[model samples]
Target: MTDRPERDALRPRLSGGLTVEVIETSALGDRSYVASDGEVAVVVDPQRDIDRVLAAAGRLGGRIGLVLETHVHNDYVSGGLELSRLTGADYGVSAKDDPPFPHRALDDGDIIDVSPRLRIRAVATPGHTFHHLSYVLEGSEGPVGVFTGGSLLYGTTGRTDLLGEHHSEELARHQHTSVRKLGDLLPDGAHIWPTHGFGSFCSASPAEGDASTIGEQKSANPAFTLAEHEFVEQTLAGLDAYPAYYAHMGVRNIAGPEPLDLRAPTHADPEELRRRLDGGEWVVDLRSRKAFVKSHLAGTVSLGLDGPMVTWLGWMIDWGAPLTLLGETADEVAEAQRELARIGIDRLAAAATGTPDELAADRAQLTSIPVATFTDLAAAFDSGGSGGGGGSATDGELPAPDVVLDVRTRSEFGDSHVRSAVHVPLYEVTQRAGEVPHGTVWVHCGSGYRAAAAASLLARAGRDVVLIDDSFDNAAEAGVPLES
Candidate 1:
């Protein structure tokens, strides 16, 4: 369970009569806010886990009169529909997205006075998404802050290419104007409350810091300083591929996603796990790469419980597929469960925690994948003795060669990468593995995080593999071919 903090513990204090508390999702570094004036409260851009939002509203000593969303989110499932249904609050989302459920279709410049103490204005900021809105919270002193869903972030705007490349430039240009419009419209003192930041793929680049203020952003943000054309070009150039699951989130939000269920998953025994594994279910192994490589179930894929776990789960796993997990500890399994819930992936069939020996009651032989450092890999490649291949099959037999797979993004691969390395970015590897050829696949990312995930996927598919478990910088240091 997410540590549900008391609303008062958050110390809800801003310039306005509003008492605000930000419920942050650490996995994605996104935030959901409850801004209230003693009488009524409004929830902005909540994650699918509505329990936290409900608790915050109850603490405010007011009824939840409105559940507001700035835009149809791309990163995770939104809690707006479920929150509105439970609280009997008016659901407000941008009309341009054309939501299927009953809602108050919010538009640009629409002011909402929730109570005598609370007021908000919806500003159309169409950079991140074509229908995005930034809600300006009006106070006695003037505008206090704006809930910027994906538009104006702390130091940069949200990414524009998530929708598709065809619309990226157009949205990037709009984002430029949107920031300028915000700068011109809001007071310099307005606080900036953006939902996406802190290493989220939704951001164009680093936020520099999490602090939010109109004055600080105007001086520091690239969108505020660059010319429209320059900003568009720069923003487009900076983007990398976001999670493939993002393509499904916006549509689901519009259609109204099901509420999150945080119930603990059923524990399956070794025999049941083997059945699922044999059935080709995505039996994910959530142990560390070192542990996974040392010994693991033959057909289970490994994706450790670290570094953007939610994004990778969404990107790599087929939607609605039967899912089970094996973790090093119960705590690790619980953490993975919560992360999966954020993306509406709660249909976990079963989960367990055990070692290869403990998990294999049948004494089925556990398999191991080899690991390599960049220094040794470079020498072997140069000597024309590529890496190892031909592993003893545990499930089925397949002939696999030594193929170097660069799991880095296209842009990263373009900037610098190993020569002759086939790039099938980490997110695309599960579905596009056929392009990898029948060989011992050597996988490497900018860092080893993605490479670990890729190597496990290859191993699960019965492909012989070795993980390049080192920094990409080492590739250059070890005299790997330099490409521009």
Candidate 2:
């Protein structure tokens, strides 16, 4: 049973007939309530934290009859169906073509009373995703607000480049129409509620500022201000490459997610770790960059073992490679497993006891590389020389290898790099390894995790490999050259 916060605790009621409540449910999702004459509640989008939404339902003291999703989300797994299961609410989605959820499909003009107090009217907004919809919430005074989803932000709009199958032209066309429609139909006082705010890559603009009125959005939003064609082209220009896991998220949301039980955490022993490693597994060190730099297992990359560990790991690490965790402690290992399972990256073969123990147990498998300081990495790249992939020794030291193989994301790789290094991101490394000439190759990434994994794979393939041991800071301080 979950403890329900006081109804008043959710949020102080706004002036209009509808009272607004915001529940800070999870790092990725949130829940809202608008209590009025009909006792209605509209759940915007939910993440893993289902209990909070349930509690909000309890606080409302009536049935939660409606759910509105702005667009298909990618950052955090959507628990839309689960919310429906817990509360017998009707799900309303904007996507007409791909109605993945079991709920009723909504289009341009559909309006429904989510609860006695809250009424939602759908407005088609397609720039973020082809079938994306925004909701106009009506209260006693009038249309009280708009749940923008990814479409119209305070000063900007959602990216049109995400869904590749849906032609940009179609999305852009719908987006233009939606923006115009929203500006025309919505009252200036309509509240603008957006899904992705700070820390989200979904929108081009930063999620900073108090909630704005429709009038403010019309004057400020670039898409709303521009003519249709220009708005479409400008929106496409700044979109960063979508994270690789986005494809998986799309399918999972459509088919309903396999229920997750976060109680059990996964970990592995050295021998088991070695076995998985031999079988093309990735060793992820779930310690902070600071903790990892102190001394972690030689080959493990440092992706913190906290919430969203698995999501970001999947985004950053090569998914094809199964994972072995090197956590800070027994608890950390379990935490890593649970978090990873949220996104279904459950390939943890075993938990490592510690770095020294693993290395001591398997001497033959332990290969060490001279770690570089952050300074070294930056200076080398700045000087038009190779960075991590071990550079040639300038003085009496051994020369850095001929080629540097960096397998981080394009964004990460582009931020800084060693000169002349061929970039084959870790996810694509194994398949593209054959293209990487056999030589004394050195591997390095933000922390050591990916580089170590790549090096291990290469060495196993009868190729000479080395790794950089220093963490991000020490590398920069050590004058490690940076490309960008």
Candidate 3:
């Protein structure tokens, strides 16, 4: 088992007797918070990992009195139901959400007194979702802080397109009004505690900083600085594709996600691993990209633990596809299992731990891909090594790539990219693999991680691939042509 440390909790002291402890899930780019007043606590927008929330509350020496959902999350399964069941806390969800669970239905303007000193007032803040609510933490003096779930983030608001493109414009307008409402409802000194926008895709754009207050946001946030139409226009224009796994999250949350199962999965022998691979199950290698590029079993995909493994794997795999994990140690596999469970991938088909040689039937089953830097790529392209005319090169020399596949995001591709690279974002690689030009394909992304994953996918699709294992910043420095 992995001897992983507990999730880091950032405890920020609020006015009055309250203190807010932040439980961050950095992998998912989201946060859950526990607001405690010495004796009782409230948990807001927790990820499926309930243990982190419990640990935070325990550290604060407070009993959990309430579990609150800001909205029906589109990114991850909520642990609210399970947490409430375990702690006997009143689970508070928006009344309009009508989730199929027993809880205290919260409406706009409803106030719940946790003690004589601390009270939570629910305020309707629509836009990220139709029924989103922001909870204001009120002390005897006035409001101290507000938990802005997906409504008002650090610098930007939550993306309005998660519901669907049809409602995007309307929601964007609503989002503008909602953010302004918060600014007007609270004093400038009230601290702003938001759930999304700390590198989360849920944010309309990238978030600016780690912390802020209403006064800080009023000076910098677009909703406060820009006109309503301008804010809506910019917000809608910034929309991009989110993870495909998000489709399952809202449905699961509304239906009430089952408790997480973190027990070790069944162990698979070499023969069983081969059989599963041959039968088209996803056999993911959870090694470093360098190790994966050096050697892996044929037909297995590389989703190195060094990268956004959970996000990319969940994005690329079929929802119910049987998944088998390969790692160097039991601890590595356990860590991956915990990460997967956060995104509602609670069960693994099987797992194997060892070198590729040990997991393969023979040395013949092991294969390695060519790894190249941007400098090598530049030299190859400059030497008249272009696509379509290739016999496989002998020895370790890569044949000039037939195609340079840019597997970065659309926004990244739009900003600047290799002059002649074909754009196919990593998430769309499986469905659009056929469109890639034939011959040896060179794959690259912002960093080597996505490129390695794309290279593996291209290899799995029966194409010869060279993994560009270097940073994109080196492209120009290494003399690879770039076009904006």
Candidate 4:
């Protein structure tokens, strides 16, 4: 498993006695904030895991007095309601959002006084979602900062398309107006703490920098710098596909998600594991890509815990389909479980922990995939070996692959990709697997993570596959033909 930094590593002190502790869920690329004023704390946009927030408040020696939600989040399940229930803090949700649970119906211009020195004001942002709110923290002197959840990110705003395509354009316009409103209302020095866009697909475009100020954003942010029409057009045009699991998040948030369950799942023996695979259930291998490529049980897809396993697994799997995890250790499975819970995939059918040999019924159940680099791929092409068809090869030159499947995003593919590579994004690989031509398929992504996952899916489908396990940056340098 990859080494994760402490979640509350970034504790930035704001004006007055208030200090903001950031709880980052890097797997999902979102941050939850715990703003404490020595005695009392207010949490903003918390993830499903509340223990981290509780720990942040504990470090500050404060009581959590308020929990706030910026909107009905489309990315992950919110911990606000349960956090409020656990701490007896008043839960705040936008008045426009009709969540099933009881919460303070926060409206625009509403001020919540946590102490004599610290107060929070709710401002209707209505960009990322129609009911989105940005909370401005006020000190005795003036406004200190704003929690712009999915509204005004570091350089761009959250993608407005999550609501649906029909509403994307309208929401983009709202996003434009909302970000400018925040810029106009806040002071130049006011810090902007956004919840999304630290590599999250929620971002309209790639966000820049870790920290930003209202003044800086005004000059750099599309909403502040571009005309309304231009901003709306640009945002809508830049939109890409988000995780399929997202379709369930908003609904779950609105209905009030079940309390988190992080306990260990039932242990499955090798025979039980085989049964799960035979029943058409998803059995994900939570090992490193290299380990998985070396050996894993057949029919088990590689979604290594070392990468964005939660993101790709949620996107590629059939929602609500039974899932079983195979990890090298209990901790690896536990970590994967915790990440899955963030996106509201709570129940695990079962899990097995051991080496592939320990988990497989026999040697026949074990399999391996050939790992290659971009240079190796280039060499294969140069060798003029016929594999899959449908490649653009000149006379005497080998076709790119039986099929050269580019599993990166459309935007990445459009930027520059190997010549004649088929473009099936990682998210669409499950349904579109048949579309891939018959032959030895060579799959690649920006990095090897998605490629490994795609290769596993192809392998599970009984297709011969070679995993190009190198960075895309080396493609051109390695003499792999590329075109924009």
Q: Report the Cα RMSD per candidate.
A: 4.4, 5.5, 2.2, 2.8
**Candidate 4 residue-wise lDDT, 61-111, digit = tens:** 799999999988888998988999999999999988877788999999999
- Name the regions of candidate 2 deviating beyond 4 angstroms: 1-13, 17-40, 55-63, 74-76, 95-102, 204-211, 265-267, 306-308, 316-324, 329-338, 346-374, 377-484
Candidate 1, residue 398: Cα displacement in angstroms equals 22
Clashing pairs in 1: 400-439, 401-439, 401-440
Local distance difference test, candidate 2: 0.62
Clashing pairs in 3: 387-402
Please, what are the lDDT tens digits per residue for candidate 2 over residues 374-424?
454454454444533444453334344556677776767777775567788
- Model 3's alpha-carbon lDDT is 0.89
lDDT of 1 by residue, 1-484 (tens): 3333544545448766678778888677688888887679989998887887888778777789988898888888898999999999988888787777989999999988887778889999998989999998877666888888888888888998877899999999989999889899988888888888767889998777756788888888999888888898899878887787887887788888986776778999998988988888988888778888889888887787766677787888888888998987888888888888878787899999889888875766488887777776666655564434343322222222267789988888888877777889888887888888767777889888889888888777777788888999888888766677
For model 3, the stretches where C-alpha displacement exceeds 4 angstroms are: 1-9, 387-396
The 0-to-1 C-alpha lDDT of every candidate, in the order given, reads 0.81, 0.62, 0.89, 0.89
Better of 1 and 4 by lDDT: 4
Backbone clashes, each candidate: 3, 46, 1, 1
Q: So what's the TM-score on candidate 2?
A: 0.74
